[model samples]
Target: MRAELLKPGVRPREVWAWAAFDFANSGYTTVVLTAVFNAYFVSVVAGDADWATFVWTCVIALSNAASLLAMPVIGAVADARAEKKKWLFAMTVLCIAATAGLAFAGPGTIVWASLMIVLSNLAYNVGETLNSAFLPEIAPESSLGKVSGWGWAFGYCGGLVTLGASLLVVTQGESFGLTFDQCVAGTMLITAFVFALASTPLFLWLKERSVPRVNAGSSTDSSGTITGAVAESFREVTRTLKALPRYRDFATLALCGFLYQCGVSVVITLSAVYASAVMGFETADTIFMVFLVNITAAIGAFLFGYVQDAIGHKRALAITLLVWLAMIVVACLAETRGMFWAAANLAGLAMGSSQSAGRAMVGVLAPKARLAEFYSFWNMALWVAAIVGPLSYGAVTWMTGNDHRMAIAVTGLFFAAALLALMPLNLDRGRRAAEAAD
Candidate 1:
């Protein structure tokens, strides 16, 4: 099936190009969202821990909420036309430009910095929504699992390379004679470059697949009117929900995603802080920890990609969640840096697996025509979790005064809940039911 996507076709090159898109944009998620830039945000740019947490929380909450609100309407428009690629390109441009502009922001005007964060997040989420829809068009069913995993694998690797480079510049700031702020700003510029350059292949190579008519709950926007489409989109959501019971596996997986992804985000968001403030680890070692985790994540993506193919998405996700729970327990018990390293690796192992397979599961369960709409729901679930994780972490840290123990314990509960939610999805039974329906 992947062989077909790679061969001569209207979208052969396009398929590969679309896969590269993940590699391109992963820098933002890795460098900015979770690792270096986020570290910089809390430690330097914002400088105040409480203020930093508040800003991070606000930007994340707003951006994700915007992504949730706008996604369905945007997706419905694309799915109703042959212009998914165009919208994707446009959103990519928006993200890149906004991220590039981050180079200009410095130690003043908190509003500007916060705005940049929100805009950057908006672009990232928009790109994700459209990029996901492209997969079903390119990869056939037989190769979808591997192809999806490969794309994610590349993304993790890309994140690793950028993260390593960012750390190098950060560590060598004095010898290079640049201020720490300048070095940190350089990451945003570098982020923009890698994202833009990596994404060029997809823009040049992938042909746009023809869009089909609106699916069950979607509507047309031929009049180019926002008010009308917005009204209809609300109606569509209502209809999608009323009919959602039929897609039980999909709904359950979404709930699982909400819970576990929150756990994942909380850990990633607070890792550096946890190391520095709670465990008394140094900045360099913290960055190294992040680098190590990403490396492990790259491996995990491949290993679990295979696992998903063999055992199916539900079982694979469940196992990963179980592993996540164990990692949190280890975090609670660990007394030194060595133990934390072990926990980080364990987390990396589950991170990509849950994400890659979760997306694949949605692709498999959704109606083909409504793929974009369903992905909107998937993206929404992620944002809902995203909102909860960081805020909850901040609250736990504030209340318990033991960032290490309290944060890990709270996140562990989320993972445990996710595992419980995933239990009913017996792969064989689901396969039989799907087949029977067909």
Candidate 2:
């Protein structure tokens, strides 16, 4: 089956170009969202630990909610006009600009910093949605898992590189006559530049593959007025939502994805905070730990990419979720730094596997004509989880008097629920439905 689906003459350069976008954007995920900026925002910018937890969660929830509402509409428009690359490029620029602006956010600039985070995160999420939609275009069905895995692997490497650079600036800034705050600000500029430089190949080399479809309710004409295009996009989005129930398997998968990401998002967003609050890890220690996670995550992504193709995406995802469940348990029980480090590595393995397998599943299940729209739905699940996960964690932590372990324990329940949700998904049926639509 794999051999039959493989396209003999697919251009390798285009495949690398497509994967390069992942490599590009991961700098922001690592430096800003995961490692440096988030902790900085909470500890320095907000100036109160309890207040910072609540505010950070609120900011993340609000930003993710906005992106959730906007992505499907933007995706519909991009799909209608066959302009995925164009939309991707626009969002990329928005993300880079916002990330760069973070350099100006100092200790007394909470509002400014919060605004930058919201805008940069929104652009990053939307850009990622567009990027994932391109998978089916560049890779054959047989190789979707492998290609997605390669992209994730590249992303981890990119994170590692950028984080390593940030670590240097952070740990050695005093030697170079820069203060801690100045070094943190320098990392933001580094993130922006690395993202812009790494993403160049994607815009220049990858071509949009989908053609505009003829429809009365939606304008496929790229030359049409902007207002008309936007209106048509909204119409298409409404139509898709109404029609979603018929795609039961896809809907089930999306639900499962949302539940799983509830756990994943919380961990990704708050790991540094957890380490600092629970285990008393300092800035350099947290950075080094994240560096270790990225290394293992890259290895896990590369290995699990082939595993999913061999065993099936659904099975592979379930396995990853189980790993995630164990990770949460480990975090809950670990009282020592060594024990927490072990759990962190487990998280790295699950993170890479689940992400690679989940994206592959979406590529396999989505109708070719509406790939972007379906990925928009996928992004919606992620954003929704982003909202629910952090808010829930924040509430729990607040109620428990900043007990991060208890908050992390709650995430385990989300993983358990996600595994149960996956029980109802019929991957074969979903694949058949996608093929029939095609």
Candidate 3:
């Protein structure tokens, strides 16, 4: 491979432009999806009170289920047509509209909030599906880890910055700061606008390539017109899954990813609420802790990119998983804010490493022609794992009636299982290179 082609297909300007979308859009997941809005909706806005947890769980389950149902079909269609950017743009718009709708959600509007969240999550999943599909088209396989790491790094940067602003506005308690309601509404509106604006350049810079073995007429209707797109997408999904079994490593990696993501998503998703409600930390303190984690996560992503290129993906992933398990163990046993911060730091280091390395490993293992389809399967597993995490956490909390610490401890077991499953896979240097070339 030439050194020139190892770089992203778009110029540096375009790469930054593309990455900014991740930076901008991540505010929704970081602040609204995981941290700020969730706590507010459950604790403050949902008045039927005891039913709050159940409502959030149902929304997550339904949203992830919808994404899983849609992702493969969308992936196959995008792969078949090689039109990732168009799909990406469409999803971005849908997400923007959904997020904007959240601005209307206020006290006693639990139903509206849940509907908007589901729609927002669906759009987030679709946009991520298309964004990931474009990775192989832009960067050479040899440099994929680095390029993907850059995106993660920027994403964390965005999360931290926007979340910092949210902290300032929400925790100020009307001492020249906006009320909680204003903060929530402002966050929603600004997040939507920024995400939509940042993603525009992707549609301009990305170039499409043809997919091998895709039927030219398959995306259209039976009358030789371009109707029934949804039905066509579903049929293609069926075709893709039937052929997926032949990809052994891809299948194994995806299963491992699914199990491991249960731990990962729970940590990020519940960190703020756990800190504030369980540990007796103030909301401002929780936000600061979140900032610390995001900073460490950005650094971890870059460092692990090097590790993935050097020591190998499976080993790097195993190392991170061990750290993750250890962190959870320590976190569960701790009693003070100091101990909690220490655990958060440890988790932050391992968090980005696991995700970036896992995805890079998938990039190497998947068949080049079916990259989009395989990645969609991988993403679906991730969201499914995410859904399981919160539901399980809520269920365990309700049953044991113990501290949230038990939920953290239980998530550790999943990480350990993923680590054990991955230990037997010997992905040596020569093998990884060969896989990448394919």
Candidate 4:
């Protein structure tokens, strides 16, 4: 195997351990967000209410919105005290618990389910931001694409394992005299267990590398009180926002990420719904399809990392965006089941490469000292996409009298616009600015 380019004091095992968190966390996202729980929430838990899809989007969007205000602050705290692992662990535990909590929801439990989603998704988002901050600490700048791609490709494998396991449980539960609902609930508990078990390596091996500062904006003192840290987090955020113009390419990248990720969020949150509602897929078929798509996504994520490094992050991302637009067009026009499958697989390829490329761009753009804090803003962008994308899909579906294909067609604009926005992002300028900051 080729050796990875890592920073001083960073071990390959430590990097692997860091990547393992993606493996652990993918279970929650694959099972809870994309493949199973979303469909379950709409068709089963909500008892097929005409408004279930809209309600699901509203609850998740509200959850994303609520957490949006707190993300930068959380990032600042982690940076202030080198507390990324601490916060990451806390969030991981809470998300696992909250995912398990989802198992308890059934008919007449809409409020219960929504509450769990808010709690779990918030924790998941925060933990993800913290986890990503470790990338710049561990990998060299030149190899960011491959390293990020490694994590993403590895993560999709994790998702595949968890999804495959969940599929077995879900498909077999009914044979054991369990209702479909009980089968799905059982999968949640299974996902939680796997998530907890797989993540143990991260805590044992990943070390915090940041030196503490009271505030990243101005303070040099490392021993300041937590209250002061919290107060300065806000100030630092303000400073960053005002100074964003200084890093024009990074700002532009964030905007493009926001727009593209909105489309991604729609796919993540609503694809299962679309499969069942528009394409007539059963729960098993949907899970299996997701499983297959994940395989392609893993391949794309792995191969495209080298591509990103070779062609540049901007070019690599633009290629993926083209794939995304193609996926959207194919899906919008698809009538037969086989045609839809081709589109979904295309989406899977774009999904994996685009996300990894975007993340690596952030790592390139962010200064070393402010990894967590800068990545927090990136996380914030994702949450904004989460809110806008799914809600827009839901709105279009509602307004068009449940015409889901039209909703998907409208979703294509996000990718188109993002590609246009990405064309002007100058990576060399961004990298020079980031090195200066460091």
Candidate 5:
């Protein structure tokens, strides 16, 4: 770690810029993935509840799987070239463009809607990986947890704003002489605008600090073709995977992350659907519920961030997972809207805490030289969970005639398995190992 980054005098502007990226992209997650567009895709676009759920899961799973393969290579290449910021900029532009394109999707445009979402989501995940790679460079190890929490906390605020705006548009579109479909499409455009406009601070203020590492065998040839670069990236990823066993604590943490995120992924991706299908929430009600959750989520991220730094990363994560477990049970058993709302609040707290703690732990456990590569693996775990969680929920729902409660109960098992995986994690030993590697 650099002396200046370790000192209390680290630039506030740089930290804010880094945090701003989270604020920027979170609009997409709030509007497109979680709150507005997803329900629109299912009910209006696809026009079939069960089939829409299946298609939604398939889109999420396929895009996540594709990104899972691409991220490690992208991270390896960025780390070798010391170009995290460059890649981040490119991915951000793609995400914004794809999100903007969603405005063209309307009734009977299911295929177009799915394609746009997949592309935008893929770019968003890539950008997320690159953005997290900057953490160690921007903040000291001592405050990494706080910084990570602040980013997520800021992100929830962004989500809250975008969701609130979408709710207004969704509810009032007809009064303004627009159809419901037009209003939904317009919300997508607003999300893209929010993402692009808010992300400017990151591009303007955050500097890339990692130096390029050009190995003789890995450097591009005089022809300037990316073929060699691509090959080198795959080789680097392979080398890192092979070396994982040597970093026992980091590897264990990765497994724990993968397991817990399965449940987390299901909760975030399908909570709206659950409200609609299981609890009979209309579009406005679902959006309002998500808006409420975002408020509490911001508070949780802000508070639990310091909790992780004060106690320890693993302990904080364990506590959050327990919260998730309880919430899942509550959600499954809830017979009324108010009961589900209670579960959503708990989900909000666990959601923020788990993400903040997981990111901080990865920053703490990874050797600085391979920070991007490690975060790539961190993304892989989440993507893998993305695959299993949604697909399982979809499969169970489809087979059981849209019985979402049973599928939700299955999600709780993922959390329980994750807690068991965390039993052996030793944060102090992991920190020592990372420092030794440095």
Candidate 6:
């Protein structure tokens, strides 16, 4: 089946160009959202309010909610116009500008910090969706698993590289005659610069394979104007949502993705918080730890790409999901910092593999003609998960008197539910459904 789906014309450099966007954007999440800025927001920007953590989660949730609303519309519009690359670039620009805006936020600037986070994160999430939508258009079906894993591996390496740089600035900037404030701001500007520099190859090299759509989702002629196309896109999104169940495997897999992705989101967004608030790790310790974990994550993503194809996507994702469960248990049981560190590295392994597998599953399952629209739905699931997972953690910690152990334990439910759902997913049927649609 994959042999038949395989096509020529995918250049290795083009593939790398696509992957470099992942590399480009990793610094934003790693430095701003995950490591430096989040902790800074809670402790400094919010003046150490008891509600600071919850408020930070609120900002994240709000941004994801915005992404959830706008992603499908944006995808549909880009699909109709065959302007995905343009939209991607626009979002990237917005994110970079917003990230730079964050540099100016300081103590007693809660609203300023919140606003920047919302804008930057919203751009980041939408841009990520657009990037995922490119996979089916680029990689042949036979290479989907490998290429998807390859992209994730690149992404982790990007995280490591950017985080490594941030670590140096944080640790050595004082010696270089930079104040703490300047170092933090410098890191943000550096991330913005790296994102722009790394993504240049993508714009220059990765060709847009999708032609203009006749459907309202893509073509302005169908709707008669860009505004009309936008309106039609909203309608198409509605229709698509109602139509999902007809493709049982795709729908089921999306559901499973929604569930597990929630767990993944929590892990990514809150791990640093947990490290600091629970395990007593400082900024430097968390950065260094996450740096090491990114190494493990890259290895896991690269090695598991072959394993995914050798076994199957479903089985590969299952293995990763189970690992997530084990990771949670380890985190919960850890009485010492060293034990918690083990759990974090275990999480790194699961994080990259599961995400790669999930991505490949979508690439294989989405209809050839409506790749962007379908990916938008999947991306919506991820945004929704982003909101639900981390927000729930915040709520749990808030209600439980900041018991991070309990918060993390609750996150395991998402993965467990996804595992149960995976048992019934028919990947072959899903692939056939996609082909039939095409």
The CA-based lDDT of model 5 is what? 0.87
Lowest lDDT block of 10, candidate 2: 1-10
Report clash pairs, candidate 5. none
Query: All candidates' TM-scores?
Result: 0.92, 0.96, 0.91, 0.96, 0.96, 0.96
Q: For candidate 5, lDDT tens digit of each residue in 228-341?
A: 776776776787788787678888999999999999888878888898888989888988999999999999999998898898888899999999999998998999989999
Query: Highest lDDT: which candidate?
Result: 4
lDDT of 3 at 19: 67
Question: Candidate 3: minimum summed lDDT over ten consecutive residues — where?
Answer: 220-229
Candidate 5 displacement at residue 261 in angstroms: 0.9
Identify the superior model by TM-score, candidate 1 or candidate 2.
2
Candidate 1 wrongly placed segments (more than 4 Å): 1-13, 214-222, 401-404, 426-438
Clashes of each: 1, 0, 0, 0, 0, 1
lDDT of 6 by residue, 83-187 (tens): 899999999999999998988988898898899999999999999889988888777777788888888889888888889898999899999999877778877
Candidate 3 structure quality by residue, lDDT tens digits, 1-438? 244634544566556666677786777787777667777776767852655655666687788888888776677667766667777888888888988898888898878888998888898988987787666666776777777777777878888877777777766647866677877777777778767766777676655654544464655424433345566666666765665455556667777888888888777667766776678776567677878788998899877887777776777888898889889988998788788888998888898788888777766766677678768878988988988877787677666663577777888888988877775564454245335546
Give all candidates' CA lDDT scores: 0.76, 0.86, 0.74, 0.88, 0.87, 0.86
| lDDT of candidate 1 at residue 134, scale 0 to 100 | 72
Task: Show where candidate 3 strays beyond 4 Å.
Answer: 1-10, 210-214, 221-241, 426-438
Off by over 4 Å in 2: 1-9, 216-231
**Over the stretch 1-438, how does candidate 1's per-residue lDDT look in tens digits?**
345534245455565577788889988887777766565666666775555664666677777777778877777666666677888888899888888877777765466776887888888888887888777666665556677787788788878777788788778876989987787788888888889988999878887675666452334545467765676667667766875677777778788889988988777667776767657765557767778888899899977877887877778888888889889888888888788889889989988888888887776776776677778887888888888887787777666654547766887899988888888765454434444444
